[model samples]
Target chain A: MRLLLVEDEKELSRAIKSMLVLSGYEVIQAFDGEEALALIENNFYDGIISDIMMPKMDGITLLKTIRKKNIDTPVLLLTANGQVEDKVEGLDAGANDYLSKPFAFKELLARVRSMIKHYSPIGENTHISYGSIKLSIATYELAGKESSIMLSNKEGKILSLFLKNPTQIIPFEKLVSFMSCLDAKDKEIELYTSILNNKLDAVNANFKLAKLNKGYKVASL
Target chain B: MSIYGDRLAQLEAIVEKGKTLIQEIINEEVKTSGISPIEHFKYRIKCEESLINKLNLRCLPVTMESIYTNIHDLVGFRIICSYTSGVRTVANKIISNENIDIILSKDYIKHPKPNGYRSLHLIVKLKDSDVPFEIQLRTIAMDSWASLEHQLKYKREIKHKDLIVAELKMCADEMSSTDLTMQAIYDLIKEEN
Candidate 1:
């Protein structure tokens, strides 16, 4: 899945992005709230992880703006403070989840997974069969008519996202945002495409991962 | 002798004594209590020195009021941990001693300040020492934001004091969240490990 990680601390952002990439997620990172807002406006993201203390704009303001735009995407607020009032404020401001800083990578992953599962389109089964590809959203398992391979979460989420929005070009930013939910450091859009290509190749699936003018597309070949 | 020289001399003597006291207490804690070497070093030694330097300011009074009211150079230690829960761990550990008097206590994590600052403050008197020192415990993120805010607020125009204050308060709130999230993340990682 693609995700947008909004954070200002360069070292921490880099660390979080690295962790996400290692988990096989495509991530897009923005240093400030304004940048995050612009990315949200220009593309679609499955989730957003934002830091509250930032220059240009703060996380609350960014969340408020994203919500005002009527964007239904799940947002997770990251703050240094774990005050109940702050948590309440974030929730009231439209954050789907909240996490504090100096966090462990595993908890973040769990929270992101929970949030995605909670916000994912209901009635959509984890198991979906289209043409020769049988995708398992829960375990990221993929089985082609002729062969099968364990797809990375990123590869599986990409496929699933495409399955949900067939024929639509998933923008690079959106992919980054979705992938960030699993991990935020892997914002290298190019790397995810390559990884997806490799996974798809291994499964020998009939789906085509294509790069559009500004985004990516999953086409059933 | 100039008043400035006398004050500086007094501060220097107090800092010297404070450092020695901190080291002694750390040694005692290590000998008697369950505390990590890093925590002992950070909470007792480093934080104590930092507080002394911060509090022994030229402006603030050097009398008892400095120890009770001021958080800067007059304070003796400020341990910035990774979580709010850790504050109690440190506090309970420190207050276990029979002689250390807990003169004042504030759990800002449980009840945050109106400005959204989150920290635990303690004023305690050492058994043998007549002077009381201030201790402020917060998450590392909170401490970082607070330090940054202090640096920023003093470096430039004084007109944006209100704006800076609000921003700092917001930052403090964010830091508190980060502390909890980090603890959760750490616990998750630990479980996986």
Candidate 2:
């Protein structure tokens, strides 16, 4: 994902830029709102993160301008003034999101990811397909040529990850990571694996052996 | 015009003719409409002082802001209601005056920005004034929320790393909806009456 970060603080901007880059995102940084506005016209960014206080133009003004131009890209504003009137004005001016300074990196990343996922367009398969089985992420269901089964919430998610990278080996560690509420205990992990395998089998999905590996792979049908 | 000079001129004019303007309008209103001239001039001033103090509007010019154009040629008042419907109630009540004329209005409620905001604005010319001022009628909850949001989110950078922007947006939405819902209850009450 590509993100544009507009902040005046050199240290904070550098730190955030490095962190975002390390997390596998391309980041374009600007020191002030004017520069940020100029860059916005020249580049296509997935998201924008801006500080409210800046030289030449303020964050609220920038947001207002961008919105007037009909740019629907999600904007996350950072501000130091924590006042009721200021917030009302910012919201009134059409900022998509507002964050105060001194924030955690993890929280920032999560917000960015959520916004991107919400606005991203799927190029081809509106339905994620793997082998003979197709899972609709939109409806959260699994469908085959002859029959269709509504997947439980957990099963539906697992199926989505598999469908995204079909015919590929999904390491056990990666699968566990995909399951947000999973525990690290060996028993629970084993149980989760068993449940996943059962669901796949029930759905008559393309499968392969566990191979005594740390993760499982989706084999050809 | 320099802000100070312009504002001072306005204030001086208001103070100079405030009482006469009030008395004349009250007499005229009572004669034509037969309503009691319970015109509380101080109520309007007190409301202005309270709003200025509460909103920390010290930076504003010391002019006839937040006027009470009802009695004075220049009047401003903020109608603070218990629910959102109160905004409409007060607005409709004011407009019911055949002597009043609406100059400008804004409906922030029906068409809020993406950030989730709602408010109603009305500018009315009282029975006698050629000049128009402002009257801001908003639910107390909306007023309070607007105040908090200004301080917490819009004024400066937020330092809270725990709550993400999405969470903040959700909170804003909930508060906005609550304001409207509270207003709806008031509407129901008025209907019963």
Candidate 3:
């Protein structure tokens, strides 16, 4: 999963970035909300973590700005003030989750995980497990109870999306955007899916892709 | 220029044109016949990511060449009506104009899906634009069934999922009948008046 971590404290920012990196997230650091917006213009992240107190562009204003632009990327606001009203103000301004500072790293990690899951289409899941099938993003592998093998980048990215929201119908257009396919047609989608299905069968995975409303869905067979 | 910028702009214009054309048709029909057939409608362009996914899924290449030709729903709309007959009335009124061409049409209301999904689908080409757009015509009941079906089906983590699926399908059938009965009642009132 990719994340934008915004904090004015250099030491604290480094601490969180390194911890998130060690925990298998791709982290981008911004010193304040101003820098965060600049980064956001050029990049996309699964989730964002920003501190309420900052050098320029306070977190509340930043949250309102992004929400006004209809950017639904999940956000977790960090604040030194743990008051109910402060949290309410953040939620009212469209923050997804909130955490108080001087907090446990474990709690922060937990909040981040849930935020990513809540916005599952962004594919923040490095590890996706469904039924007996297990897919690893870092290793680029899909494994069944009996076997495991390496996956091509395309296969891995597509599977990553499927695993994150197995029940959701991934529209054909979304799959193309996610995979960055240069060209595609519905028939080609069927062909690619069948090829992937054969590989899944070889690995003894318990599910196959299903067609729904001009899109594909993953369901247990 | 960005890679998909041109195609995205084209799709935006297509959707805008479709919306305007639909409004114009509705206005003309009301002016000429007094009773407007269309209840409400909504239109949108498929986002770049989604349009590409659809192109790829259709097995069409995801290139600019395939974007407009193979992915038909890059620009689409849903036309909602209060009565089942209103759907066809509005569709015919819109397409009967000499400048409009009905490239393809499917009467799904007459032949519901196995899961009980029902709607009339039409692909239309304007006089000026070579790229076609999709239009779905459905009654209020049918639209309700569709929206609920989408909500229930996507939340796979919910408990009693199979039971809920079965029940939702049943509800769709009920809604389909309700649509017919409602239309019949409306016709009876019209005949009396």
Candidate 4:
């Protein structure tokens, strides 16, 4: 998963980013809300974690602005103050959840996982269809018209991502970033792509993962 | 020969701890309400074979990390109450506890399943453990119906499956109504005394 973490404290941001990275999440750090907003405009994030207090813009204002723009990305707000009013304001401004500053890292990780699991469109459904292929996210089984094949967790995630963005070329960097491996190499992704292609062939899927210049896209067979 | 032998043992310990914690909460609720809301409770740690089967069904690798992240009900508790109100009382007491974190709560009693199953499900994690567990609260009547329904679900190649399912739904509805009436009677008796 990819996350945009907006925090004004550089030291704390670094600490959190490292921890998230170790937990198989690709984290983009933004020192202030405006920078975070700029990143959000150009990129897609699985979730956003932001501190309430920031220099250029506060988290609440950023949240309100994003909501006004019809961006429904799940957001978790972090605040130094543990006041009920702060949490209420954050939720009122479109935050999905909030955490007080003096929180355990374990709690933060759990909350992040919960928010993403609850908010993801694919998370709510058992199966998703692209072309003539039906993929069960719950079972990691991809079914075509004639047959079906089970996929490894990594392969399932990659296929799910491709299916979610059928028309776009997903960058190799983004693909590698979301993989569980901390030091995932391009070759490893290539191997996974090959395995996925073989599975598609096995199941007689009407669509295949086509390699682009520096990315991959689902193409009609 | 199971790779998860140690993990299963750990989970059993956690289940024991969870049982004690839930029993304490139930006892405290009894003191405040002048009667125990829960009629009885049972707890279990998921066995190795079942865990492996679940992992394989989900196409997850049979690894410790996969179990930790993907499975939420390594330990499970079933609390059966004599009345529907008792189920709510026990659920509220557990939810209000400060010692455990509530990960998720589903009130199937208010909005029951399509098959008419009724229960309150909770996923919780204790303060000291990173592992999450499940708690299910249901009235005695609902429990009875669910137990039978579960049996019917697992029976392979049952004749007249649709008819049996419809009958089961009707039975669940009757049981639910009876539970409500029983709770009303209990309340009236308490009022008279």
- Best TM-score among the predictions, by candidate number: 4
Candidate 4 wrongly placed segments (more than 4 Å)? A1-221, B1-3
Residues A1-221 of candidate 2: C-alpha lDDT, one tens digit per residue: 67899999899999999999999998999998889888775455668988888999988888888766545467787777566565677878866667776789998888788777765222235676656677776765555554344454565566565554343345565456446655544443444455545444434566632524544545554
User: What lDDT tens digits, residue by residue, belong to model 1 across residues B37-77?
Assistant: 22332333224445455567546654445643554334356
Strongest candidate by lDDT: 4
Candidate 3 positional error at B187, Å: 0.8
Instruction: State model 2's lDDT.
Output: 0.59
The interface root-mean-square deviation of each model, in the order shown, is 20.4, 20.3, 22.0, 23.4
Window of ten residues with lowest summed lDDT in model 1 chain A: A179-188
In model 3, the runs with Cα more than 4 Å from the true position are A1-221, B1-3, B158-161
Tens-digit lDDT track of model 1 for A1-221: 77889999999899988988787777999999899888877666667888888999999999898766555578888977567777788899989899987789999988888887798631257686655677777766565554444555655666676655444467766666655545543334655565555445434667767777878776666
Q: How does candidate 4 fare on TM-score?
A: 0.46
Candidate 2: which stretches are off by over 4 Å? A1-221, B1-76, B153-155, B159-169, B183-193
Error of 1 at B68 (Å): 9.9
User: Each prediction's DockQ?
Assistant: 0.00, 0.01, 0.01, 0.01
Residue by residue across B1-193, what tens digits does model 3's lDDT show?
Answer: 5445756677677778778877887888789867667888998776767776676677888677777667667678999887877887888876787777899998776556667688999998888778788999998888988998887777757898678766776576556645654564566556557
lDDT of 4 at A104: 93
Query: On residues A82-164, what C-alpha lDDT tens digit does candidate 4 reach at each position?
Result: 57888999999889999998889999999999999887536466888878889898877776664454566777788887776
